[model samples]
Target chain A: MVGIEPRVTSYLDYATGGFTTQYAAMLVAAGVCDTVACVFGANPRQATVGDSGAYVYDPTYGLVNAGAIAALGWTRYMSKYETVEEDLGAVAVTFRRHARLNPNSAFTEPLTLDDYLATPYTVWPFRELDICKVTAGGAALIITAADRAGDHPKAPVYIGAAGRQQAPLELAGDEHLMCYAMTSVAEQVYREAGIGPGDVDLLMATDSSTAAVIHTLENYGFCEPGGGGRFVREGGIALDGEIPMNPDGGQLSGGYLLGWLHQVEAVRQLRGECGERQVAGARIAQYATTGRWRTDFLSTIYVAE
Target chain B: MPDSVDIRANEANEAFEAFVGDHELRVQQCDGCGRRRLPPSWICPHCLAEEYEWIAASGTGVIHSFIWYLRPLDPAFLATPYNVTIVELAEGPRLISKVVGVQPGDLSVGQAVEAAFEDGPPGATTLVFRVRETADGAEG
Candidate 1:
C-alpha cells in the first residue's frame, strides 16, 4: 500500500464493521486480487450508514434486528444495576479530551461529564454523546501483500495477528449480549500473537456505542466481566491508564468512520507519529470491530517495526 | 384486546403468522430437546435438530428490560415517544415488544406482564405487553 494505490475499490455499506478490515480481508481471501482498497466516505447523496439519513433500523432494513433492541435494553437495565452509565459518561469525557490531540478528528471541543449527562437520550440508554457522530468524510486503507508493504510510510507496522468470529443473533439463546463476538476474536488473536492481554500496549478499541466499549473492555479479557464499569470509572482504561484503551477517541468522540479510522490511529501510534496522544514506546496495538450482525466481530493486532 | 389487526408476515414467518392470527402466542419448540426459540428458526441450538414444532406460550412474562423512544423513527408506530420492552415469556423464550397502558417510569426489572395483540402498521398484528395485576378477589 505504500508504493501504489489499489485500483479496484468495492462498495460496502458502512454499518457495523462491514467495510473496514473484514471486507479488506474478504477481497484478498476470494483470491481474485492480492490487494484492494477499503474506502468509506459519507455525504448527503447516496447516504452512508451512521449518517442521520441512514439510521434505518426499521423492519425494512436489518441493522436493528429482533435481538438488537433487546440486547441494548438489557445493557441499559444492567447498567442501572451497576455504574456502567458513569463508565459510559467517562468514555465520552475521556475521548473528547483525546479528540483535542487529533486535528483530523471531528468534534474536537473538550467535553465534560456534566455535558454528557445533560445530552438527551436518543434511545433509552444511548444518549447523543453515547454514540458516534454522523460524520461526512472518507477513510481508506490499502490491503496489499505483506512482502510489498514497505516504503513511503513514516514507519511500517506489521499485521501481527488477525481473527474473527460470528455468533448466533437470537434473543432466545442468551440472557444478554454484553460483548458481541469479541471473546472468540480475542482468543484467536492472543493465540496467534503468542501473548496475552498483558502484552498489549494500546487498543484502538471500536466503541460503536458507549455501552459497547464497556462490554468490550470486560469481555475482551482486558478485565473480568462486571469489572468494565469499575475499570472505566477508576481511569484504568484512560489515556494513561494500565491498558491505555481507545487512544484515538474511538467512535464516541472520534467521529464514526465505521471503526476503520481507529486502525489508522493504531498505525500512527505504533509508528510514534501521534504527538500528544501517543503511548510511550508503544510497540503493540489491537484494533477491533463488530460487523452488521450484532454478534459478528473481528480484531486485528499490529506490531511496530 | 386493543383493536388487533393482521400484519404483512413474510414467508419465513408463515408458521408464526398462522398461530398469531389465531390469537395464540407461540414459538418454535425443538422436537428433540423440547427447547423453545424465537424468530421461529429452523434449527434447535440445544439438540442440533432440524425438525421443530410450534407451542403456545403462556402469554405471561416478566419485563426483562425496556427503552423509551421519543422519535418517529419508524413511521409504522403511530405512537411517538413509545416504550419498547424485551419480555421474557413464561415458556422461557423472549421477544421484543412494547408495553402499553404504562409509562416508562412505571417499568422495572422482573415486573409481571402479560401479552396483548394490537393493530399495527403494514396490517401486522403486533404483540404488545401490559402490566399483569395480582388477583386477590378484590379491586385495587
Candidate 2:
C-alpha cells in the first residue's frame, strides 16, 4: 500500500534487471509519478540440486523444468553474455566490494579479487558471486507529491525530473548490449532535469550486473560510453568522489528485493538517516533502472533541501 | 535447426511487399516537414500531415555503432554470435540490421556496410545487413 500498483511483473527468464530499472526510472521522470515500490523474490524450494549442494531456481520454473534460480542466472549468462568468466567477473567485483560494509548482507566475508577470479564458474560467464542469492524478502515505498512531502515523518525529497527509453527488446536484434540504451536514456534525463553530470551528488542504480552499473553511468552522461569500467577503476563513483554511487552497497551487497530498497535508501539519504555510509551534504540524487539486456532504461532525479 | 521463421504477412504489411518487389528499402517520408517515418506511419510524425511519398534509399552507409551478442535471445540464432549494427545510410537515415560475415572482435567504429534482405515465411522478408570493405581497400 506504500507504493505504486500493477507490480511491474517481469519474467526473470525473458527480462533483465536493466529493463525493470529503466521502467521505474522512466515512469518517475515522465512525471507520471515520483517514488516507486519494487519487489523481487524467488522460490528457493523450486531449486534443483547441483554440485556442492548449490541450488538453482528458475524464474520460469512452473513453465520450464530448468534448475533453480541460480541455474536460471547461469542460463541467462550463457544466452545473453556468452561466457561465464565475464559474468563471474561482474558478480565477484560487486560482491567483494559490498561485503566489506554491509551487516545485513547474506554473504559478508571479505573476498579478495583473486578469490572472485578463482570461484568456480556456475555458468561460463557467471559464478557463485556473479548470481544474486535467491532469498525470500519483499520491499515497498511511498511515492507522493514532492512539494507536499515534508508533511510525512520523513522530509520531502523532490523528484526534480526523470527519463525513460528503450531499444529493441530482443537482445540479438539490439545494436549493442553493452551500450546504446543507457546513453540515450541519460541524455534525455539530463535534459529533463535541466542539470549536467557534474551537478549530481549520488546515484542509486540497479546493479544486477557489473557491466550494467558501469555502462549505465556512462550512458547517464557521467562519462562517455565504454568509459564506465575506467570510471569504476578511478574511484569516480566512490563515497568521496565528485559524484557518489550506490552508497548502500546496491543490490550486489544489499540482498535483492526487486528495487524497492533502492527507493527506500534514496529517501533515507534525503532525510539524512544513513550512518557512516552517508555522503555528506548530499542534496541531489539520481536513480537508474535498466533492463532488456542493457538496451532498455529509465532514470529519475531527486532533490532534497 | 533454423533460428527463426517468418510467418505469413498480414494486410497491414502490404507496403513491405512492394519494397521487396523493387529490391528497394522503402520508408514513408513526411512531405509536410521532411521527416522519415519508421514502423510505417499513416501520418507525418513531425507535422501530422496525412500526405506522404515513397522514397528509395541508396542502401549504402557507414556503421555508426554496433554490438556483438555472445548468447542468443531467440532459439534460432543461438549457435552463432550475431552482430547488430546501426548503419548511417547515404540518405542520412539510420537503420538497424545484423552485421553478417565479420568476427566480433574485428568490428570497428565507422565501418562501411550494406543492407540485405532475408526471405521469411510467405510474403515476409526481414532486412539484414553486412559490413563492406571501404573504397580505399580498408577492411572494416
- Output the number of the TM-score-best candidate: 1
**Clashing residue pairs, candidate 1?**
B6-B123, B6-B124, B7-B123, B7-B124, B7-B125
Q: Global lDDT for candidate 1?
A: 0.69
How well does candidate 2 score on lDDT at residue A301? 77
After best superposition, candidate 2 residue A160: deviation in angstroms? Answer: 7.2
**Model 2 per-residue lDDT tens digits across residues A1-305:** 45537534434443233344445555666777565544445445422211111322111111111112223233322333324343335334544564456555545567666777777543323344544544445554545544545677657777677676767633223333454566677787788888888898888887655555655666677876545555665667777765677777676666555455566677678878887778788888887875444455677777886
Candidate 1 displacement at residue B123 in angstroms: 5.9
| Model 1 C-alpha lDDT per residue in residues A1-305, reported as the tens digit of each score | 67777546555554443335656666666776787666666564422224232333544212242224433534553834465567678878888888877887767777888888888766565666665655667776666666667754555677788887877766623323555467888899999999888899998776766666777777679887777777887888777898887777777666676676888888888989889888998999988776553456778888998
Per-model DockQ: 0.30, 0.04
Question: Per-residue alpha-carbon lDDT of model 2 for B1-140, expressed as tens digits?
Answer: 53222221232146755686556786667789887655455655468786777787766777655545454323334453555555667766565565666775766556677777777566666666777767787775
**TM-scores, one per candidate:** 0.84, 0.59
What stretches of model 1 exceed 4 Å from their correct place? A1-10, A13-34, A45-81, A172-176, B1-12, B42-51, B71-78, B119-124, B135-140
lDDT of each: 0.69, 0.57
lDDT of 2 at A188: 79
Each model's fnat? 0.30, 0.00
Each candidate: RMSD to true structure? Answer: 5.7, 9.6
